[model samples]
Target: MTDSTHGPRTLTVTEDFAGQRTDRVLAACFGDLSRSRIKNLIDEGRLRRNGEQLGNAAEPVRSGSILVLDIPAPAAAFPVGENITFPILFEDDDLIVLDKPAGLVVHPAPGNETGTLVNALIAHCGDSLVGIGGERRPGIVHRLDKDTSGLMVVAKTEMTHRALSEDFAARRIDRAYLALCWGVPSPTKGEYEGNIGRDKRDRKRMALVERGGKEALTRYTVLKAFRVYAALVECRLATGRTHQIRVHFSANTHPLIGDPLYLRRIPAIAKSCPTDARDVALDFPRQALHAARLGFIHPRTGEKLLFETSPPEDFLTLEKALGSD
Candidate 1:
């Protein structure tokens, strides 16, 4: 059953879902809504089973039980539009590409509640922002880490959003990053493959593991070597796992220079560089990684699109200080 108003949806539990948790059943039924949302509905008494308000998301469901969910419209959440603006690399009817700078959070969160790329996009896109995915993150197709600078694409329409998301999930998008690591990776170039998941000891960080993790692959090539202290490398992602590039490189002991999370301590190579370059290597503010290139097909027009951007001034300054040796 379905109701247009209030988005009331009814689902009848079948043998397939019998004995499953109510939240799990609802998650399967409403693929677009997150499981947390379903739990919130349960807590708010908006979810009912057999005409009785069900407050526990983990309650077991019986076969043939009827479940009703009254989903409220999403609120206009955080990251309200601000006067802040970013550089637009490309724009069209379907999407907008931006050259995001380091230190800018991609979306607002608990600590970062304003002045995000979403806020800028909201101001820039205005009413053209498509809210099909969620009100808080309109048109956001993918994200770059707050400290990783460079090219990013955001959808302006639902059609483009779905198509672009599918492309990313299917690994059809071409993403390349430029990184300066503590030392030159061996053999100049190779593929780094591993399974990645949360670090059991440190939940906030991702780690490479031998099991129970998602497969991640990254191909890298050294572009320039700076003495024995650092090197400029190009990385292409085959699987975009959380902190995939950073985790993989760190696991290989060539962590990105200035990476606070992955690189635990200053590498011995840092002391070997020239005085100025050594100072730059030790004092760089953020990770020396940039999403330098991005390519994907236009969701609507089917035209292949590619965009490239150089790293920010700070990154370039550090690189120049390092020089080629």
Candidate 2:
């Protein structure tokens, strides 16, 4: 019922939980804490009933019994701030919008532990970044692939984190990406709908599967055709799935330029391109995809927010080279 050095939390049993097990009752009351966590606390003698240490988690509890729980502060397992910096589109007390460049990992993972957007955010947001999401991810609301350049949003507060996550799940967020593909699509503008899942043969890759896969949809419009060999296209996501754009385009035989995994061989059209443009296309690194636009409703103010950004210098150079031919 009161705060103390032991991180005490008190609960009073009501008539609704008159004959329930103690652990189940506590789990129902504490929405934020998991049942396993409550059991751990009970096993550690950190839970007390009527000022006495409770012994069994399955024991019955009566109405009007006062229970005290000692919950420890979470360990400092979140990523620390580093001095790295990225382009910021907008920032407020609740959230931050960033124009992330290619090669910048969004968070620390097994093969990547440094020079991530999370490291930079820690340095920028300081202690304010603590515990917005999980300790490992901190304020991260969504993710961008390491090789994909894009506009991304991060939450700085728990309230914003929850709201933004809900918005993404409800498909209320709008995201548009620009890509240069191997060939111009026939219809110029259309939607690709399929179920996407991991490839059975290659666990690391995604595939368009007939069953046991999530529904994925990508709507694309051709912006320009480049001499029948390549085309610039803008894709809008109806459902955000892993590698949705790349996998869908590849499946349709129009893989994006510079895609190492999906684009296995050079298109025949490349042989007809001007020497300079052909060289640029051949030597290009990473996928030729950029998230050009992002739109969502503000969690706190109820205002609609939209953001746009151009691709980085390398992408522009490649585009210019291709356009010259």
Candidate 3:
């Protein structure tokens, strides 16, 4: 997808808006733009009046003056490519499907600026991969959390990026996850629906709030159950929100094992497992969740594409310890 940020915008100051603050006038005219943003643009010399750049945001507008603001293209300062290795499932000129290992971040941030999947994709797919993703995320169409290992698809071209994103947004993409939760949810197979939003008290965490939250649905079937201690479950999402699966399971009192953010304490059900299994579950390093399957329509080929990957070795070990045969 391409950036839809507006082009050079021209506004005229009429008699009614004369003597009004430049920032206020622009902000009021462009209801979507904030006064502070207008001020920043003015300070950056993007706002011009009478063919001269304007520096002050508080300056009064003159009647019948033409104000032109040139919005520059977003900077494409992608992180330098790095020689990082991940398991590639499929690749074409349009996209790449891979099994992202646990601990690898999807994109760069303040502290994690260098080593990311984006950097790796840049190195592998070359500079062309930098132009497709709608936002700063170069090739990233969707994301798997840093600790969630599994199948992911990254677009190589803008057409593919927009198409894949549309498919995902329309819920046409087939996706499923495998998770190891602390307790087996009742009724072997069912769907959990809730409105997930930020926890009112804990800003860092997401919760199933009664008001002011996006609706989220997770359908799950217990794949394997270790008595009442824990279970391996297959989850399909109807709506994707930040930490939807983790939040839903946690809200249902069946938080995933090793989920540091959501699993705040050792669950009493752990005592029900054998001592070794209990210890293994407690010692698990990251969230026991994996994006096991991803399927979508290929934009270029007009073909149905699906990719699936087994959980990483560590996840397999954890499940084995939980008594998976």
Write down the lDDT of every candidate, Cα atoms only.
0.84, 0.85, 0.85
Ranking by TM-score: 1, 3, 2
Give the Cα error of residue 240 in candidate 1, in Å. 0.7
TM-score, candidate number 1: 0.78
Q: TM-score of each candidate?
A: 0.78, 0.76, 0.77
lDDT of 3: 0.85
Clashing pairs in 1: none
Per-residue CA lDDT of model 1 for 242-317, tens digit only, reads 7889999999989998898998888877778888788878898788999999999998888999998888899898
Q: For residues 97-208, could you state the per-residue lDDT of candidate 2 as single tens digits? A: 9999899999876567777898899899998887778676789988888899989999999999999999998999989999988878989999998987666556456788
Error of 3 at 229 (Å): 0.6
The model with the greater lDDT, 1 or 3, is: 3
- The root-mean-square deviation over C-alpha atoms between each candidate and the true structure, in angstroms, is 7.7, 11.5, 10.0
* Tens digits of lDDT, candidate 3, 226-288: 889999999999998788999999989999999999999998887788898888889998999
Local lDDT at 100 for model 1? 94
Query: Which is better, 1 or 2, measured by lDDT?
Result: 2
Judge candidate 1 at residue 21 and give its lDDT. 87
